[model samples]
Target: MSAEGSRAAQIKPFVRQALVCPVDKGPLLDAGDELYNPRLRVAYRIDADGIAVMLADEARKVDEAEHQRLTA
Candidate 1:
């Protein structure tokens, strides 16, 4: 697997399962570089160290086109 894929998969299933959206407590999709919340149309960035930055204030709002790309 690629390095990025390995990094993304580093988060154990149990730990990943415990991560939820700060706004609605919905499940966050573990993308390689960020966690995506389709319901809220926002994304939480994952740092280079494979740490998800789950701060609500730090959430980057996704536009419709990007939202489609993410959810797709």
Candidate 2:
């Protein structure tokens, strides 16, 4: 990310509300700096611009314990 794009650390409320899992088309939870899809146990990183990295291939797989925490 460029320095200019790193200005925001939080996703805009409206943007967050509109975000969904690219794979499942399900709602995503704003888990700090990442968007988590608890149903699929995957997480997408938030860019420095506070935009979601919504690519399915780039999503990180959540372990069972981590999934528990994310959902909790």
Candidate 3:
């Protein structure tokens, strides 16, 4: 099998279970060959078909920063 195809085969299960839009904490919908977060307006392309990635928004960053600040 081609590299891309093999990668996709490995990623399919993880994508189905673990891939969620970090910004909204909601399920990402597959958009053609890619995945998209409607709330964050970010599109994630599978890396070499093996890893599903999601870009978090500024709100998440701020939340994380605040969390760290509180913990510190």
TM-score against native, each model: 0.83, 0.82, 0.49
Q: Tens digit of lDDT per residue, candidate 2, span 1-72?
A: 442333223566677678899998999876767888999999899776666788999999999999888788
Show pairs that collide, candidate 1.
Answer: none
Alpha-carbon local distance difference test for all models: 0.81, 0.78, 0.53
- Full-model lDDT, candidate 1: 0.81
- Tell me the alpha-carbon RMSD of every candidate: 2.3, 5.2, 12.3
Greater-lDDT candidate between 2 and 3: 2
Clashes of 1: 0
Per-residue CA lDDT of model 3 for 11-69, tens digit only, reads 66655677787767787655433455555555566566456656553222224443343
Which number leads on TM-score?
1
Model 2 TM-score is 0.82
lDDT of 2 at 48: 67
